[model samples]
Structure formats: structure tokens, C-alpha cells
Target chain A: MKTIFIGAGNVAWHLAMLFFKNKNVQITHIWSRNKENAELLKDKLDKNIEIYHSLDSLDFSKTDADLAILSIADGAFESVLSKLILPKNCILAHTSGAQPMEILKLANYNSIKNIGVFYPLQTFSKAKEVDFSSIPFCIEANNKEIEEKLTSLANQFSQKVFQVSSKDRSILHVAAVFVCNFSNYLWTISETILKEKNLPFDMMKPLLEETLQKALEINPSNAQTGPAIRNDEKVIEKHLNMIEEMNLNSNFSRIYKLMTESIQQK
Target chain B: MKTIFIGAGNVAWHLAMLFFKNKNVQITHIWSRNKENAELLKDKLDKNIEIYHSLDSLDFSKTDADLAILSIADGAFESVLSKLILPKNCILAHTSGAQPMEILKLANYNSIKNIGVFYPLQTFSKAKEVDFSSIPFCIEANNKEIEEKLTSLANQFSQKVFQVSSKDRSILHVAAVFVCNFSNYLWTISETILKEKNLPFDMMKPLLEETLQKALEINPSNAQTGPAIRNDEKVIEKHLNMIEEMNLNSNFSRIYKLMTESIQQK
Candidate 1:
């Protein structure tokens, strides 16, 4: 399978590298809004591959690439699609969890017959190496043929792949925000609280690890335990007072109160 | 070493079981306000163990126990201490994370020479079994002899033990609420969101596991990702709107907004 990458961001970099190492998949072309980023990604791949600084300069009709993956930001979908001209037979997919498949069908880009979404449901960072096999891939396509192609490609790298609809994917994205992003913010708050007292953040690591493990093994709601779930008002009031006494952010107290109430509501 | 347990709650149950397995420690006596609970705990341990139904009936001065562990709730500490009497040489300790060591210095209980704290820093559930080796035991005592005895006992069961001060332990407890309790509540929120959409929460297992792994590998402040950190107003607005559309708990949106603001503030 021949593929072209439409962005050189974190998602694109990781996907391109994964595909580049696969003998069956060939990354033929790449482009990004930033020329340096495009070049940086190209340097990581085969030198023989073509790097396009501007999408308008690349002639999609003349290329034989089977797929064009738009791994750009959510806001860039409409603008990127307007300028992107693709071969009628080539499959076009965006690697976004929030956007729908209809977003790929821009007014000028209707000539592109195939449209799909190939979302790798995991957080990506340039500094960290991810194990592609463990990451779940959520595939959504306008039609069966395009879906098969995307699923087959994802199967080559990942062990878990599912055909999720645009609606379900959006819901999954919301939940992902809670588990990944919001929980991470709570972790950041914990780190700050410890820092103020000269306590090493490392002390919380063992508990953090066990919390996740228990949540996964048993359902999170069933596994929940604390002063909040126990409804120990004395401990709750003491913690709230301590947070205020320490001169921490007011948001910390709000979060603590809200989370405690939520846990009790269940 | 001989030990007496003042409460037969989760902490007492787990600790008694652990000490029962160790040859160096022996649980000589057990008591709870509810005699049934004390009997339930006694059944789990050796049949020769003595059970005290009321603190008033037990003659503490006549018992040969060297240590008495007050593993009751924070609210119950004062009432339980008022009725309880201990031998002159017996060390009195509570397995609490929030209360200060000075809390053990009750007016009538001042006759007791030694007081200490043995707080196992982990969330315990009756249904789940925990590995004692990994749990960090925070030990605090009024004097060196009692501190050494508690430290030696904790060392027998756990690989990690620290002499945390009362001020530091209280700070640690607050930090723990964020990382363990608060983070777990966010997980419960995620589960609720997915369930409302008829989506399997199991689908999120991979992402949930990786989020913790990433936070621990890279500092959570630095590991932060998602729309909030990106200041992606488009995605944030869409997620907030979606949360309202789902008719989920209003607290979810409040938590969402507060956490997003907290992340960006840093």
C-alpha cells in the first residue's frame, strides 16, 4: 500500500514512522504547513521520499498513492481539505477523534470519492516512544471498501481495532478527556501540593499505580475508596482547611469538594 | 511483639491478617464497638485470640500486649480514646493519615508513656488483596523507642518505610486525595459518560492504563496534553457543549471547566 502524509505533527510523525518500518506499507509523500517540520519528518524516513512544502504544489492526480492521511489539527480540517486535491480513487482519512467523517467532504474536495477516520486512541508526545501494538485504533469510513482498507492498514500495527461511528467516537473522545486529560490535571495538582511542602512527588507513585490497576481489574466505581466515598466529613473538612491554610489555589478546594460530592452521589 | 487492635475495620482486618502470617508479630487481642465485627475479624485469625466486646470491660493494665493500634475512623478517635485505658508501658498508635500524632495525647490517657503512628499509605478494599511489600508505611512516634518498634514492624512487611512527621503526613494525605481519590473519581466520570452512550467502558482500558504510565515516566506537569494545554478553544467549546447535550451531571461540566482552567494556569 502506498500512502501520503498530509501533516508532520506528533500523530503524523508516529504513524509515518510505524508505516515506514512495515515492509508492506510505503510512505511515498509528505507535507506540512511548516517546511522545517516536513523536512524533519522526511529526515527520519527514507531520503528517496518526496517532501512537499506546500500542498498546492503537489499534483494528486498524477500520484499513484493509495491513501492520503490528513493528520492535522482539528481546526485545520476545513482549510486543509479545501486546498487538498486528491485522486478520485484514493482514500482520504483524518486522524482525529473529535471530527466527523463529513468534515473531510469539503465543497471543493468532493471529487475525492473515499473519506474515513483513523483515530489512534492514545496520547502522543514527540519525546516518548509509544508501543503501537497496544494502542487502540478507532476506524470510521463513509463506505465499506474504505473501511476495509483503513482497518487492514491499522491491523498491521495494532492488536485492537474497532469500527466506531462518528457519534460513538465523539462520545469516546469526551470520556477520554476525563480519563486521560482531566485525570492528568489532577496529577499535576497533586504534584504542586507536594512541592509546596517540600515533599517528593515520588511518594505518591505507588498509590497512583495501584489506583489505576484496581480500577481496571474491577470497575472504577466499585473500586472507589476514600474519605469522600466513606463520607467522613471530619477528614474532608480537615483536608479542605489544610488546602486553604497552605495557600494553594482556590481551584484545588473546588475540585476536592466537587469530586468528593460526585463520589458520594454514586 | 504483642499487639492489640482497637478497631476491626478495613485497616485492622488487613493488618491483623498480615501480622498473623509473620512469626515475629502476634495479634493478642481484638476489640470493636460492635462485637460482631470483632468476632468476624477474630474468625479470620487464630482461634486462640481474645475478643473484647467493650473497652470498659477490658482491663488494659492486666493485658500483656506491648502495643495497641487505634485503627478506628477519624471521628471516632476522641470517643474511643476517652473510654480506652492502656498499660503504662504499652505504645498507643493510630493508623490514620490525616490526624496529627498529638491527637493521641488525650488528657486521661496521658498515663501512657509511648505514642506513635503506623499509617499504611494505600487504599484498601475488602474484596481486593494488596501486596504489602509495595505499600509505603509512614511511621511517626512521640519517642525513639516506640518509633524504632513501629519501624521494625513495618520493615518486616514492606520494602518502603519512612519516618514522616505529622505535618508532612497531613500534607501527604491531601496530595493523596488528589492523585488517588480525585483521579479515581474522574475515572468514574469517564465510566458514566461511556455507559450513557451505550459504549463499553472496557474500550477505554488501554488509554486509561497508558495515561498513568506516561504521567509516571514523565512528570505529570510536563506530561500534560489535550485541548486545555493546547488552548484549543474550538475543541474545548465542542466538548463542553457535548457534555451538556448528553444531559450528564452538571458537576461534570463544572469539573471539566475547573480542571481545564487549572491545567492552563500552570
Candidate 2:
């Protein structure tokens, strides 16, 4: 399969590298609004993959690729989609958890024959390596043929593939926010609190690791602990008072109070 | 070194097992309110370790032990300390992160000569085996001699031992809540959301593993992502509308809004 990547960001960079390494698939073109960014991604792989500075320059009539992947930002989806010119048989897919598949169809309703979603339900960082086999790929398409084609493509990288509807994927994205992004913000707050006292953030390493391990092993509801879940009002009050004394910011106290109340509600 | 354990809870059980395995130290006695609970802890190790149903039953006068550890609940610390009568030369330590060492001294100021704090900064579960070498031990004592003695004891189990003051440990405890307990609650909420959509919680494994790895690798503030930190109001609005549409408890929506606002403020 020959594929054209529509973005040169983290997701596109990772996917392009994956496809380039797999003998069965080939990355033909890499596109980004910035020429330097496109070249950076292209430089990571073989010289055979073409780099494009603008989507307007690509003539669908001149390309042999039929699989075009839009791995751009969610906000840029519609704007980038409007500028795209693809072969009539091209299978167009966007790698977004929150965006719906209908947007792809609505963008070029008359011109495009295939529209799908190839969302990888995992956080991506360009500096780190990802084991694609463990990452879950949520695939969706307008038709059975496209669904099977996308599933087959997903199977090359991951064994965990599901045909999730747009609605379910959106819900999954929200849940992912709570687990990945919001939880990360909690770590940031932890770092801030520890830094205020000149304590090392590394002190929380073992606890952080064991917390995740326990959650994976048991239901998180059963795995809950600490002052909030324990209903130790004294400790909670003391912590709040200390936070008040520190005068770092109000969000720390707010988060502590709200989460405590939420846990108690459960 | 002969040590007497004053509780048979999760922390005590794990600590007792660690002491029993080490050739340098000996667990002289295990005490719990319920006789059966004490016996259960003793059953996991050698029978030579005596079990006590009450602190008053075995006279501290008859014991050759100089190190008595109070591994009981934070709420019971004062009550347990008030009842204890130890030799003048013995060192007394309580494993609590929030409680101050002064509380231990205040309970029986004239009766006790040495007071200290030995806080193992990790969550413990009875069924799980923890690697003692990696767990951080926060040591505190009233005198330098006792502090060094406690540090030597802690070094037997872990290389990561630090002399933390009561105020700093209290702050560390609060920081720990954000990283461990509060983060675990986030996972619980995530599980609840995914379960509502008939999605497997296992789908979040890769993301959870990577989230922790990234946090440990760099500053979490630099590692922040998703709609919240990205300030993607469109996706955030979509998520809030979906939560409302699901008619799930309003807590989900509230958390979404507050966390998003908090991230934007950062």
C-alpha cells in the first residue's frame, strides 16, 4: 500500500516512521504548512518519501497513492480538508479521537468515494518511542469495504483494533482526558507543591508507578486510598490549611476540596 | 536489633515480613486489637515472633527490645501512645506522614525518652509484594543519635532514606495525594465513563503506562497535552455537551469544566 501523510506533526512523524519500516507499506508524500517541519519528518526516513510544503501543490492526477491520512490538529481538520485534492478512489481518513467521520465526508462529498477514521487511542511524544503493538487503534468508515481496508491497515501495527462509532470514540476521548491529560495535570500540581517545600519530585516515583500498576490489576474504585477516600477529615483539613499557608495558588486548594468531595460522594 | 511491631495492618504486615527476612533484625512481637489479626500476620512468617492481643497484656518491662514501632492508624496514634510504657533508653517511632513527632512526645512526655518518625512513602496492600529496595523511607527523630540509628535501620531495607521534618513530610503527604490517590480517582472516573459505553478498560493500558513514563522522564508541565492544555475550546465544548447528553452525574461535567479552566490558567 502507498500512503500520503497530510501532517508532519507528532502523529504523522510516528506513523510515517512505522509505515516506512514495514516492508508491506510505503509512505509516498509528507505534507505540512511549514516546509522545514515537513523536511524534518522526511529526513527521519528514506529519501523516497516526497515532502510537500502546501496541499495546493499536490495534483491528485499525478499521484499513484490512494490512501491519504490527515494526521493534523483537530482545529485544522476542516481548513486542511477544504484545501485537499485527492484521487476519486482515495481512502481519506483523519486520525482524531474527538472529530467525527462525517466531517471528512462533508468536506468533499461529491468528489470523494471513501471516508474513514484511523484514530490511535494513545498519547504521542516525538522524542519517545511507542510500541504500536500495544496501542489500541479505533477504526471507523462509511462502508464495509473501507472498514475492512482500514482494519487491515491497522492490524499491521496493532493487535488491539475495534470498530468504534464516532459517538463512542468521542466518549473514549473524554475518558482518555481524565486518565491521561488530567491525571498528568495532577502530576504537575504535585510537582508544584513539592517544589514549594524544596522537596524532590522524584520522591513520588515509586508511588506513582505502584498506583498505575494497581489500577491495571484491580478496579480503580476498589484501589482508591488516601485521606479523601478514607474520610480522614483531620488530614484533609490540615492539608487544606497548609496549602492556604503556602499561598501558591487557589487551584491546588480547589482541586483538593472538589476531589475530596467527589471521592466522598462515591 | 530486636524490634517490636505495634500493629498488624497492611503497613505492619509488609514491614514485619521485611524484618523477618533480614538477618540483621528480629521482629520480637506483633500486636493488634484483634487476636486473630495478629495471628494472621504471624502465620505469614516464623512462629518465634510473639503475638499480642493488647499492649497491656505483655509487660514492656519483661521485653529486651529497645525499638518499638507504632505502625497503627493515624487516628489511633495518640491513644496507643498514651497506653505505652517503654524503657527510658528505648526509641519510639510512628509511621505517619501527616502527624507531627511532637504528638508522640506530648502523649507521655515524661515516660518516653526518644521519639521518632519512620514513614515509608509508598502505598501498601496485603496481597501484593513490594520491592523494599525501591521504596523511599522518610526518617525523623528528636536526637541525632536516634536519627542515625533509624537511618541505619531504614538503609537495611532501602537506599533512599531521607531525614524529613514533620512540616515537610506533611507537605509531601499532600503532594502524594495528588499523584497517587487523586490520580487513581481520575482512573476510577475514566473506568466509569468507558464502562458506560461498553468499552473495555484494558483499552487504556498503553496510555496509562506511557503517561507515567513521560511524567517520570521529564517535567509534567512540559508533558501536558489534550484539549485542556491545548485550549481547544471546540473539543472541550463537544466533550461537555456529550457528558450532558449522557445524563451521567453532573460531577463529570463539573470536573471537565474546572480542569479545563485550570489548564487554561496555567
Candidate 3:
């Protein structure tokens, strides 16, 4: 598979490097809104790969690349698509969890036949190494042929791949926010609270890890514990009072109360 | 050191087992309001150990127990302490994150010389095996003598032990709820949302693990990601709409909004 990579952010950097390592995939070109970022990504790959400063400047006719993977921000999808021109038969795919595969149809070159989504359902950081084999790849395409192509390509790197719809992909993205983003925010809050008391946040690490492991082993709902689930009103009241007394962010009290009620309601 | 174990709940079960395993510590007596539970706990240890149905029946004077560990519920503390009698020299302690060591002063046996707190900062499920070596043991006492005794006892099983104050211990408890209990609830919400879409929750495991690993390595505030941190109103609105469209729990939308606002404010 000959591919052109767009975007030089975390997701793009990881995916481009993965593609470069796979013997079956050849990353022939790279592009990003920021030329320096594009150069940075190019530096990580074979030196022969061409770097394009703008989507329009890339001559799709010259490379014969079979696929173009756009790993840009969700807000950039429409604008990037509107300006991007691709070969009539080349596959165009966006690696976004929130955006629909049909969004790829907005590419300026209307004749482009295969537009799809190659969404890798995992958090990525350029500085951290990711084990791609276990990450779920949510693949969606305009038709069976495109779907098979994308799934086959994804299978080369990941053991888990699914033909998830745009609607379900969006739903998964929301769930991801809750589990990954929101839970992380809660962890940040815990760290802040511990810091205020001159306590090391490290004290919570074992419990945090055990909570996650237990939640995975037994469904999370069944693994619930603490004052909220136990309905220990006295402890809850004490905590609320402590939050107020400490003059911590009002959100701390609010979240504590809301989460407690939610847990009890469940 | 000879010890008397009180309560038969999760905390009591784990602590008794740990004390039983340590060659330096001998669990001479066990008591719980529920005789059946006390018997069950006793069965897990040497058959020679005594099980008392009531705290009043446990002759602390005869047992030569230097340490009496109360692992009962917070609500039971006052009632238990009001009726409990301990030897003058026995160290009386309670293993609770929310309760203060001073609460042990309520013991009817006023001559008791030592009162302290032995709070293992981790969640325990009776069936789950815990690694005591890494668990943070937060010890608090009325004086230095009792502090060293409690610290030395805790050190028998755990490498991490701290002389935390009652005030700081309660603060740590609140923080523990956010990081462990509350975060697990968010994970439960994610599982529910994914289940509604006929998607396997397994798809989220890698991302959830990575999110936690990242938060621990980098400060969680710095590890924050997704629409909230990006301040991407479009994606946030889309997620909120989808949550409503799915007719999911009302708390889902409320939490999503609150957590998003909190992340952005941070």
C-alpha cells in the first residue's frame, strides 16, 4: 500500500511511523498545515519520502499513492476536505472518532472513489510508545470493497478491528471521553487535593490501579465501592464540609456530590 | 506482638490474614458482632485461634494481646468503643480513612495507654488478593511511642508507611474517593454507553489503561486531553447531543458537561 500521510500531531506521528515500519506499507508523501511539523514527521521516516507544505501543492498524479490518511483535528475535517484533491481511484480516509466517514466525500475531487474512516480507538502521545497490536481500530467505508481494503490494512498493524458505523463511532468517542478524559480529570483533582494536604499523590496509585483492574475484571458497576456506594451519609457530609472548609474549587464539592448521587442512583 | 482482631469485613479480613502470615505477629483473638463472620475469619487462620461472639466476652486481660485493631465500620465505632474494654497497656487502633485516632479514646477502658490509627490506603475486596508491600499504610497515633509501634507493625507487611495526621488522613480519604471510587463510576458509565450501542467494552481497555498510565507518569493535569482541554465546542456539543439522542441516563449529560467545564477551567 502506497500512502500519503496528512497531519503531524500525535496520532499522525504514531500512525506514520507504524506505517513506515510495516514492510507492506510505503509512506510516499507527508503534509501538515505547519511545514516544520511535516519536516519533523518526515525526519522520522525514510529520507526519500516527499514533504508537501500544502494539500493543493501535492501532485497526486505523480505519486500513484493508493491511500491518503488524514489524522487532523475534528474541526479541520471540512476545510481540509474542501481543499484536498486526490486521484480518482485512491482511497481517502480520516482517522477521527467523532467525524463520520461520509465527511471524506467532501474532498474537492468529487471523482475520488474510495472514501472511508480508519479510526484507531486509543489515546496517543508522540513521546510515548504505543503497542498497536491490541488497540481497536474502528474501520468504516463507503462500500464493501473499501471496507475490506481498510480492514485488511488495519489488520496488518492491529489484531482488533471492527466495522463500526459513524453513529456508533461517535458514541464510542463520547464514552472514551468519560472513561479516559473525564476520569483523568478526576485523577487530576485527586492529585490537587492531596497536594494541598502535603500528602504524596503516590499514596493513591495502588488503589487507583486496583480500581481499574477490578473494574475490568468484574464490570465496573459491580466493582463500585466507597462512601457514596455504601450510602455513608456521615462520611459524604464530612467530605463536603472539608471541601468547603478548605476553600477548594467549588467544582470539587459539586462533582463529589453529583458523582455520589449518581452512584447511589445506579 | 500478640494482637486481637475486631470486625470481620473486608478490611478486617485482609489485615488479619496479613498479621497471621507475619511470624512476629500472633493473632490470639478475633471478635465480630456477627458470630458467623468471626468464625469464618477464624477458619482462615490456625484452628487454635479463639473466636469471640461479642467484644464483652473477649477477655483482653487474659489474652496478653498488646495490640487491639478495630477494623469496624465508622458508624459502629462509637457503639463499639463505648462498650469495649481493653488492657491498660494494649494499643487500641482503628483502620479507617475517615475516622480520627482520637475516636479510640471513647473506649470504656480509660486506662488504655495507646490509641492510634492504622489506615491502609487501598481498597480491599475479600476475594481479591492484595500485595501488601506496595500499599501505603497511613499510621496516626496519640504519641511517639504508639506511633513507632504502629509503624513497626505496618512495616512488617508494607514497605510504604507514613505518620499521617487525622486531618490529613481524612483529606486523603476524600482524594481516594475521587481517584478510585469516582473514577470507577465514570468507567461504569462508559461501559453502559458502549453496551447500549451493542459494542464490546473490551474495545476500551487499551485506551483506559493508557489514560491511567499517562496520568501517573505525567501530572494528570498535564495529561488531560479530548474536546474539553482543546476547548473544541463543536465536538463537545456533538457529544452532548448524542447523549441526549440516545436517551441515556440524565446524569450522563450532566456529568459530561460538568467534567468538561472543570477540565477547561483547570
Candidate 4:
């Protein structure tokens, strides 16, 4: 199917590459307000793909395409969808994990018949290309026919595609924030601590890998480890003392003690 | 040279199994206060290795072992070392990361002409066996001769032997607590938050893997990701509210805010 990707951000870039990888789906046009970024990505693509400056500048009303992918930031979907001047029947989809399909409701895009969600539930970095096989795509559409079409398109890139409801996607997204956003923050916390000690972050890498492997092996509940659960007051005290000496972020000691107490609640 | 494993703790069990994997070392005996645990590990061994319940109970002083690896608890080491009567010049090593070699000097064990440390700088759970070949063994010896023998013995089990002074080892241990122990606590905090929000930790695995992989590929200072680091105050507020709802350890708010602030500083 002929397609157009609507952003030059991480997710847009990676998904565009995935679509490009499949000889079946053609990413005909790429758009970003920052034309340079769009052009940079276009340089990596097959010559057949066109590059555009922005959705506002694209003449979607006259363009003939099977589908248009909206991979822009959240809360900006309305503005882009309003700007698209496509026919009422052309498929339109936005890839926001937290936002619902209703966000794309448009009687006419100049009149697009279908609006759907193609939420790929993974964090993507513009600088770092990601593998889609491991990413779960959450699909939702205003209509069944559109959902089926979206699912087929999603399956072209990823191994798994789920027809998820808005509520479920929201749950999934909130969970992603905890797992991805907050978990990355945990690494930030480690980096802060290690830097204070003049220690290399490499020292933490093996342990981090092992922790991920173990958490996957067992139930996260059962997989939990450390002095907090064991209620080892001795080590906890020592750690708090060290935290003080490091003169770290003020919250570290309190967090350590709070977690120690939380886990100690037998 | 014949060798005896004098403890059945995490370190002892793991080291003994690895030593037996080597053809040069003889794991003649596995001694521990918990005889059942020792026997349990011994049964995992292919050969008929001996298991002794106590220091005096083992009559293997007559065995003329070249080295005795005192892998017991720190509190138990001095007494055990004092009791073990090896040949007057037998090499002795302890596996405690924090405890100094001077503890062995005080015991005055007859065979202890040499005192050294063979501290494997990694966390080992009793149930899980570690692949020592990849582990970094940090060694410190009283003299050059002892360092050479310890290096050779350590190399048999591991690819990397860091000739670390006790001072460096102590710093490494402190750094380890920051990574392993502190990181585990973060996992607990994240898990508790997830459980309260009716989410499964399974979803976090991909994010966890990606986060670790990114840190390895990029400098951690540049690898920072999350609301705090991004200065996304709205999401931070939402998370802080979520933490308040779960009563997810007071540390979560402080840690959450502090981490974000630290990243902002960077």
C-alpha cells in the first residue's frame, strides 16, 4: 500500500524505516516542520520517497495515497488532522499510545472516511534506530474495515498486533511510563550515585543486564531482591550513611529509608 | 594442588563448582555449619566430594592440602582460620570483599604463610550459579609471591583478574552497593507502583533491556531519558500524584523530583 509518514521524530523515523524495509508498503512522502531533519531521513530512504516541509504545507486534498500515518507529538494530532484535506474514504491513523481513536474523528479530511490508531508501544529515539519485531502495535479504528486494514499494515512491520481499546491503550501507556520513563529515571539515579563516587557507569551495566534477565525469569513480585525486603537494617543504615557522605540528591536517603521501610512491612 | 572449600554460602558454593570444573584444582571437601546445604551442593558435583559439618568435625587436617579457601561469613572467618592447621607454609585466602587480609594475620593459623583475597566483584544468589570465567576477580595479596599464585588460581576460573589494593576493592564494593543494592531497590519501588496501578511488570522488560543497552552504547550522561530529564513537569506531577495514591514509598516523590532536577542540571 502507498503510505505517507507525518513526522521526523524518533517513532516516525523508525516506523518509516520499517515500512521502507517491507517491499510491500511504500512510504511515498515524509513531512516535518524542520525540513532539514526530514531531508536527512529522506537521504537514507529509497529515492522513490518524497520529502515535505510540514503537514500544513502538504496538499493532501490533491494527493493520492492509500494511507497517511500521523506520528507527531501528543495534543498536536487535532491540528494536523484538521489540516489534512484528503477524501472522506482515505485511511488516516495516528500513533499515540495514550490517545484514543476518537481523537482522529473527522467527517471530512477534505473528507477522509476512516480514522484509526496505530500506536506502537515503545520508546524510540531519533538518534537510535529501533527494531519493530519486538515492539507491540496497538490498533484501534472508528470502523471494523479500517481496523482490519490497519492490523494488516501493522503486521507487515511487527510480529504482534492487538486490537486494543482506548482504555486498554491508556493502561498500557501509563504502564509504559512506569516501565520506560520511570525506569530510565532509575538509571539516572544510578548514574548520579556512581558519578558522585567517581565510578564508571560501566560497572553497573552487567548488574543491570542480570536484573532485567532475572525479572523476566520470575514474577516481578517474587523476583524482588535487596536489603529492603530482607529488612537488613545493618546494610540499610550503611547505605544511608554513604548516601549522606556522597552529598547526593536530598531525596536519595529518604527514598532509601522509605523503600527499606516499605519492603520491611512483613 | 589439593584445595578445600570451607564455606557453603553463595560465594563458596559458586566458587567450588567452578573449581571442580577445572582439572587442576581438587575440591576435596565442602565444610559448613549447615551440613544439609553442603551435602545438597556436593550432590550437584559429579564426584564423591566430602562434606563436613564443622571445623573440628573434619579430620582432613591430615590431607596436606596446599590451600584452604575460607569462604565463610565474616564473623565466622577468624575462628575457622584459627582452627584450620595446614602445613606451615600453606597458602590461605579469604573471599570476603570488605574484610581486610589482616584478619587472617591475627588468627595465626600455622599453615598461613600467605594471606590474600580473591573477591569476585559480583552478586551471587545461593540458588543461582555464576559463570566465573567472565567474572572479574579482584585480588590483593600480602606479597608478590602470594599475588602471583592468587592470580594463577583466579585466572583458572576467570578471564579477568584485577590486582586491586584493598583500598580499591573497598571503593569497588561501595560502588557495587550503589549499582546492585540500590538498583534492586529501584526495581522494588517500580514494581510496587505498577502493582498498585493494576499493571504487570512484564511490560517493563523491553524498556529495561533497551535502557541498559542504550547506556552501554552511549555515555550514560547522554543516555538520560524520562520526564525529569526532559523537564516534563506535567508528567512528573502526574507520576508524583500516582505515587501519592499508591503510598508508593515517600522516597518515590523525592527520588522522582531529585532525579529530574539532577538531569536538568546536566
Q: How accurate locally, in lDDT, is each candidate?
A: 0.87, 0.86, 0.87, 0.70
When summed lDDT is taken over every stretch of 10 residues in candidate 3 chain B, the lowest stretch is B54-63
Between candidates 1 and 2, name the one with more favorable TM-score: 1
TM-score of 4: 0.82
Per-candidate fnat, comma-separated: 0.80, 0.71, 0.76, 0.26
- The Cα error of candidate 2 at residue A81, in Å, is 1.9
**Interface C-alpha RMSD per candidate, 1 decimal:** 1.0, 1.1, 1.1, 3.3
Which pairs in model 1 have colliding backbones? none
- lDDT tens readout by residue for model 1, B1-266: 78898888888888888988999878988988878988998998988888886758546777878888989888888887877788778989899999999888872466678999999998877677788898999999988988999999999999999999999999999899899988888888889999998998898888888888888889788788788887878888999999998887998898889899888887
TM-score of chain B of each: 0.94, 0.92, 0.93, 0.87
lDDT of 1 by residue, A1-266 (tens): 78999999889999999999999989988988888988998999999888886757546667888889989888777777777887768898989889888988882465688899999999887777789897889999988998998999999999999999998998899899999999988898889999998999998989998888889888888888889887899999999999988787888898899889878887
Candidate 3: give the clashing pairs.
none
Write down the DockQ of candidate 2.
0.73
Candidate 3's error at B181, in angstroms? Answer: 0.5
Please, what is the TM-score per model? 0.96, 0.94, 0.94, 0.82
Q: Which stretches of candidate 1 lie over 4 Å from their true place?
A: A53-59, B53-59
* True lDDT of residue B21, candidate 4: 78
Weakest lDDT window of 10 consecutive positions for candidate 2 chain B? B53-62
